[model samples]
Target: MERLDGARGPRSPDRRGLPARGLRRGHPPAHRRERPGDHARDRGLGIALSPGFLSAFVFPSFRRLWIGAFLSSIGTWTQDVALSWLIHTRIGDPFYLGLRTFASELPLVTFMLVGGAQADRVDRRRILLVSQVFQMSMAGALGVLYGLERLGIGAILVIAFLTGLAQSQSAPTYQATLTSLVPHDHIPNAVALNSLQFNLSRAIGPVIAGLLLARVGTGACFAANVLSFVAVIVAIARIELPPVAALGRESLGQSLKAGIRHVVESPILSALTLLGATASLLAFPLITFLPVLAGDVLHTGAPGYSLLLTSLGVGAIAGAVTTAHRGSVPGRGKLMLLAFMACGAATVGAVLSGRQWLAMALLAAAGFSLTTAFSTLNSLVQEHAPNELRGRVLSIFGLAFRGGMPVGSLVAGGLVNAFGAPAVLAAFASALFLIAAAIRLRNARLRAL
Candidate 1:
């Protein structure tokens, strides 16, 4: 059955498709670093797990790390909103707007696999430290450039790409190590809590940026974000994790290949990847053109733009809470299906609505659906992947999560300039509905969850 001595043979697959060694103590996966407290948790030794969200926070280390991550995410959203507003208002070009989105996400597709392999082989904390430093520098540069009136679209894109590159390198490591700070039973709650922090920041950051954008300026938002990186770097240093056993490292290519092979063999994992990629490529690009939506349709100026983004964030937070509570529910695929249909309906309704308030309401619905679909997909990967392959699997998830947005954005950006945001959005929304239906019907694995 299960062994803790780090030696084992392949066991039979469970419903989750987790590898045999995954449940054992055989060769340590990238993320499994055994510690004293963990040994106790594993053996159910003198510990009681709390119900719902409270359980994840019982560990002092996880709570501190969550706080830091929340602060950093808020800063990131602040910078993102400020930068997009600056590009749209100053340059007034939809193509550049699309290019900006593309630059930021491109590295996620290209470098994330290597980053995943690195997480398995190297010190994850070091990776986070380096990435944070690069992001801090980039934010500082943006603020300086804006203050000096030297900021241009080209320079902005380059900075965005560099910061994105840094994020791509560090995210897999951070995600892989997430469960290390908590007991095995709390991983679901932990993941849900992590989503909550991000979505909360998503809502709050844009609202704060909106106020600053109209009053002080974009530079102020950028400056605030620059300071936020400090929290994450400090958190990483303060949290002491279990000692990771030393193991021989694999070459980057071989390591990546192994990860790819794992996904290829796993039916459920492949379905999850397709689910995210389709949503990203088709449904998400519409989100990038929010500036155009406000300016052209609503004519509500900066405040209207801000409110629309806030609605999305608010809805996302609701979705995260629902997911957190659904941890005990076994039907992930069924939930994702309902959410996808809702997302499609909401997108179409938002596009067609003539009034600003109605559009915002519809977008909130879309936001809720988006979180449900993606987060459920994410949880599937975490549950099914073994500890050693966790980073690589999550990296593939990250790749699917991020890769399609740029291609869609770039395409939509050009078409928006020619036809308009509404026409392009409507076209993609229709395509997304059809794609979801086809994929859902064909993949029994996705339907069954």
Candidate 2:
């Protein structure tokens, strides 16, 4: 049987006598023959290639997931900000706040391989559903505690840990599921769209959380988060995705070894992942210090903290939008290198700024570079990985991206405690940018590939 692209209508059996899967007789494969001018044979040197970027928005499956996830992410951000504030207010310790972040992210580093293996072995939708339910339950518990005024730092930390575990389990499956939603031709666009939704939510979520925090109590933010999960659950329940058959039937350990081997063998993926991991390890931890930046350095309190978070979200949204418009331009190696440099520059700018507005602007720039680099790397990994091993590869990708945060938070917190926020920020920014530049220069294949 020959598979036909559904976008161009039905396909009919040709002289080769292949059976068309879902097409009417007497028609060629939709994707086999291109219309006049469809293929870019020649163009001016400066002309940009447009790869039908709008098709991503038209794909129903991806559209549903994007919208649903966006709504849910807003709630997730609200809950995150509220929880961070709650912990700080209740415990009054940056170390504990750092530890809370560590507890939530540490599981990803440890269990991401297993999670990826599971995503490859089982139905991704089911895995997502299970994880969502677990996360929702935790959110509900926190909401209840908040409503009753019984929420304590310890309870919040424990719940955060559980939610982190669920996130670790869910992320690989979610990443892998994107490929199943659209035709292979649209995978890049789908990935970009996914990033767009996430960044969009990031931009808007903090603003909403800020407003909510200013009006209602932080408990209400948790409650709102509890409601957000419902959108994702319903969206997943309604999606009719392509069947994903199990492949490369091997033990979890063997599969993990295979993924690691593939990464080692593929220098481009390895370089990108390493650069991403290093950047994440150094720069991403500053987020855990935002509350402190607001309280001590800026003297703005919770509302100021909220604005700082929102600014980063807005920057991320801008990055995602830029990527969407660009439509997977090649040379991600250089782009990633530049993004890291931009991130480092932004971080340095942020540290040097004494004014709250200037700090927010710098943080926003950093957010843009951070999201762009991370999202580009994510798409690159997905594009390069074999279909069977994609889940595991992406799980590793998630681990590198997320797992670094906990370690970064701990280091950042300790540095802040010992020296100051500015010193830690400066050290992290300088080290990360320098390392990224060194890596790019050391690996020629990474730049060429």
Model 1 C-alpha lDDT per residue in residues 379-444, reported as the tens digit of each score: 677777777777788788778877888888999999999999888888888787777777777777
**RMSD for each model, in Å, please?**
8.3, 8.4
Candidate 2 per-residue lDDT, tens place, 1-449, comes to 00001000000111112212232335543233323233333222233335464455444445556667778877887888888877777777788778888877777678777888887787667777777878889988998988888988788778877777776666777777766665666676666667667666666767777888889888788888888888787777655444455565577788788888888888777766776577778977777888878887888888898888888878877877676666556687778777878888898888779789999999899988877776677677778888878878877766776766788888888778888888888889998889878867877776664
Query: lDDT, candidate 1, residue 52?
Result: 71
Candidate 1 residue spans exceeding 4 A from truth: 1-50, 243-249
Q: What is the clash tally of candidate 1?
A: 2
Over 4 Å off, model 2: 1-53
Q: Looking at candidate 2, what is the lDDT of residue 120?
A: 78
The candidate that achieves the highest TM-score relative to the unseen native structure: 1
**Each candidate structure's count of clashing pairs:** 2, 1
